[model samples]
Target: MGVDGSDRGEGAGQLLADGEAQISLRQAEIAAAADALRAGGLVLLPTETVYGLGADAANPAAVAAIFEAKGRPRFNPLIAHVADLETAARIAQLDDRAYALARAFWPGPLTIVAPIRDANAVCDLARAGLDTVAIRVPGHPVSHAVLEAFGGAVVAPSANRSGRPSPTTFADAVAETGDKAAAALDGGPCAVGLESTVVSVLEGQPRLLRPGAVTRVQLQQIVGPLAEADDDAKRSPGRLALHYAPDAPVRINAKAPEAGEAYLAFGGGAGGERVFNLSPTGDLAEAAANLFSFLRAADRTKPSAIAVAPIPEDGLGEAINDRLRRAAGFIG
Candidate 1:
């Protein structure tokens, strides 16, 4: 805890000011980040979706520090990142559907929640002592390299303080987590910009716990129909009623921005003095990656309220709306 927050350093709060922390996508930096994880310390690394505060998944003490660093609730389980499918098979009991999806989307942004085997090394604290574990193989090269170098599972949740938007850039990761990370690997901006699409295959049928860049339609093709996970399940991560909130109140699906409101437009510009467009060309993929960054920008303007343009509830839009609904709860 003295330097790396290793032995229960929940006190490793934000120590660096704005622009003070830096992470470059270099071999030396990646090697140092991997070393930190191996030593029971936390490091912020890039993923295809968003930056994650990574810790040794097999070490309960290291996992606890992740909650301490982000002030994240213990009820939410963390996702285990694996280097390859061989590593994932050792941790989870992969069924036919699980095998199908993993083959379709490994080394990508899809998280599969499967029944945890007794042989798995992931700690109970990382899975909230549940029988199921959420697992994914990130597509980002930086994350993949670190996982290979670390040589074990790493539980990585979004690298942001609880209730705030996830960090999409290295700067964003530093601004949110501060010196909690012993080191960070800058892999530029995240491609998806949202968390992974979590599919729980624990039950008889497949369930979609959280939406991301992976569209519902794509999953349907491989596994017929998908059911939305129950609210009482509490088995998956990112299921809270109020999450990804900014400092200011957020209002979604506003036909037009009211007076004194900062408009957050999706397809085009909103008729407001201050406006930030998610995707002017109506591209859902681009909008998904830009969601949190734009929200953080709009919050800095100190508007009376943040009004959002209507977003289509298809494909990546589903994930975008999910975050918006949770952020609006900041007002409720």
Candidate 2:
């Protein structure tokens, strides 16, 4: 597929280098990125959580390309990103709980998985052939513009290669999958550096599949005593045993850095060249935004391991600790 059904000069995989793929948030660039998606090509765009590798949700070949490019497991479903709640309804059969959550968190960093409404809106491969589909309305202006320009649902997973940390900065996104995308939107650094909190409303009770910028407490207020993901975990992405990992191993809840370990401090207690504080003031929101970038930076130092300071398991800290536990391959 190509522009107006005409062939593009090259396949998406043969696109230019990362530098050339980076596009600004100007109108022309956004239109070009949308065009790429229409022609069955991947587009790397920003979201409130992290940069996502996007493909037309309805295009089977285009969706397949995303899995191939990222080496992502097909069993792990992808989230269909839409511009508005109206578009989201076309793909997911949202119930009362889903609508309640969406009304409170749509156009933000919360993903709701519901029974499939319009099967044609999102392809089987994108949903991993499940009856449920994960959908979200991103808060980032750049991604919102692209979605409107594209005029349909776009299934986007984290732009990083399979199980690695999601790219919070545009540079890291380009480094991960820029070569495979037809175009990329540069939205600078993401504000919410974690992935969206995934919740499934398909069953009788709402379930939290994965944690992210949206805290459990925030979701609990809307849905009331959310259930934990059991077999339903297969309906969500980022549920793998090992995820958001860096090149070096990670050690969580460490008091201080070891001889060769890089310290990821929570409160501003540690100092030194090797130590990277998540937040100088012990702010959970600040730590959440700084999590992935700090992990990437600490990994670049080539330390034997990355030791993380204890983060309170409340509100946003819950999401942060979840990521750390996954990074250390402790829990799924």
Candidate 3:
């Protein structure tokens, strides 16, 4: 359970005592959460990557509510979460590459962008009026259960305000979106704490738009070469130049801590008055999962500057660095 299950028990109980609107993330309440979505209400649920603020993808009003809740720009698109491949195929025009990628990476971290079929039920607001939709089938059981129960596409963006750190733990999900969301479900900390890797296939080439757990090497193994996105490449969710930022000023590729700066260490050998290590053992996957949480923690210190240790661009590190660069407000 999330808030209803001893997460900030005092606050939850006080809210309950006040008889305000609140719900739990326990197994028994999945149906209620589904019902909320079916009625055009917003819900925050766990995913393998991170918690997502979700609404029915086919509901334009619901989609607009998400934009309002997150303060997200209407120009950026949202990823539609589906229960299964058949559900995905019904909404997007998938090709051979798309099929191969789905077979290999569905139920995992990967969002495939493809043309929306004329028969697609997803509303235009969800797709930001684009002809394509970014869709994925998350592997988290809680997310899967919700999707299966809801029995339709859910457009879920990370459950945080726009340009803020994405919530990985259930506690943070509830903390960030408790008031705006109808309910926030806790499935535990996310396995892949970063967002999904987004690839665009609408241009007839598999272009790497955003990196994640599924590396370009792995995608190429199934779909041949993946190209770098162009300057004018169609924007998807999380494509902003100044995204995933924290309250403090962020500096990336720091070899050592600057005086008075809070340092986010990747591996061993980083020292600071305020420090949080992403991975002390030099494991990139672990670092990827720890990136945003550590940043959030470091930001809490109210440090003069948040300096991040250099992360190698290998495997999941590419995705981690992608987020870091964006958080640091570096586009190139």
Candidate 4:
């Protein structure tokens, strides 16, 4: 298979030799990555959403390594990535609602938070000592292959350091956390290019903890009207007020960029080195896929601040604007 999860071609072998993604390394790299995780080592692997820094979910020491590597707060919880729904059921108690959502979105980018059925399956440190556990079945071929090879749950958060934009490309993932990993499997760029939509089903009605590739509209169609995350529902990650931020200050809803500001345009009214169009034709999905990558690129220029065009608040736009607001230090 190719690094992008497609069929390998003539130049496939050269990818590994040139230190790019190894087209033939799917099975070999997955095996090595799983071995590292089983031995309490960190592995940088790709997911459809973003690159993740992964460790054995059951190993407290391994889980701690992830926290230390990312400089993530101990209070923030981690999500366990499983190969299939069956594996998720073993660790988390799935009610009818959780099962319904899982059946519809598993092997995709939707995380379900539920009561812990087997506390030992995911360590207390990984769960932040909460009775609830957040679990997801990632759709990325390389990540799924590693989970299948590891034969258990793995806690994988975005590979980048805490409070930074998530890594979407293989190069960005490696630049962020490659030094701390024992192995890495580059699956090229992420398809979804955003984190999983997290929903907590521990109470009467499912609440949306964090938005991502899976929109509220899509989730509501499966589980009825969703509730917002309350104070007690702090079991999910990405809750920091100033999270997913870059070094430069972010200014949203800008009509035009100033002399020294980097511009993140949506519809098609910007140009030059500092200007990056999320989507030339105003497509939300394309905008989301380019969000973090463009943010990182703009930050590299050391601009005074980054100016963003206004994004509508419907469908995937909610998730995109959610990250933008957080980047600008306006939302939690």
Which has the greatest TM-score? Answer: 4
Could you estimate the TM-score for every candidate?
0.89, 0.92, 0.90, 0.93
Q: Regarding TM-score, does 1 or 4 come out ahead?
A: 4
- Residue runs of model 4 more than 4 Å from their true location after superposition: 1-25
Worst 10 residues of 2 by lDDT: 1-10
Measured on C-alpha atoms, candidate 3 has an lDDT of 0.81
What shift in Å separates residue 153 of candidate 1 from its native position after superposition?
0.7
The lDDT of each candidate is 0.80, 0.85, 0.81, 0.85
Model 3 over residues 36-154: C-alpha lDDT tens digits? 99999999988878889999998899989999999999988899999888999999999988988887887778899898974357888888888888998877766777888899999
Q: List the candidate 1 regions with Cα displacement exceeding 4 Å.
A: 1-25, 118-120, 269-273, 330-332
Q: Please list all clashing residue pairs in model 2, or write none if there are none.
A: none
Mind giving the per-residue lDDT tens digits that candidate 4 earns over 1-332?
Answer: 32332111112122223423443455676788899999999999887788999999999999999899999999999999998889999999999999998877766778899999999999999999999999998766677778888999999999999999999998998899999999987777776677888999977779999998778988898899988999645788987878889999999999889989999999976678899999999999889888999999999999999999999899888888888888889764
lDDT of 1 by residue, 207-290 (tens): 988887677898899898988787425777887778998888899999778877888897764444578888989998888888
| C-alpha RMSD (angstroms) for model 4 | 5.0
Q: Whose lDDT is higher: candidate 2's or candidate 3's?
A: 2
> How do the residues 186-280 of candidate 2 rate in per-residue lDDT, one tens digit apiece?
77787778898899997678999998777788788888998899889999898787999999999999998899999999886689888999999
Give the count of colliding residue pairs in each prediction.
Answer: 0, 0, 0, 0
Report the poorest 10 consecutive residues by lDDT, candidate 1.
1-10
What TM-score does candidate 2 get on C-alpha atoms?
Answer: 0.92
* Cα RMSD, model 1: 8.0
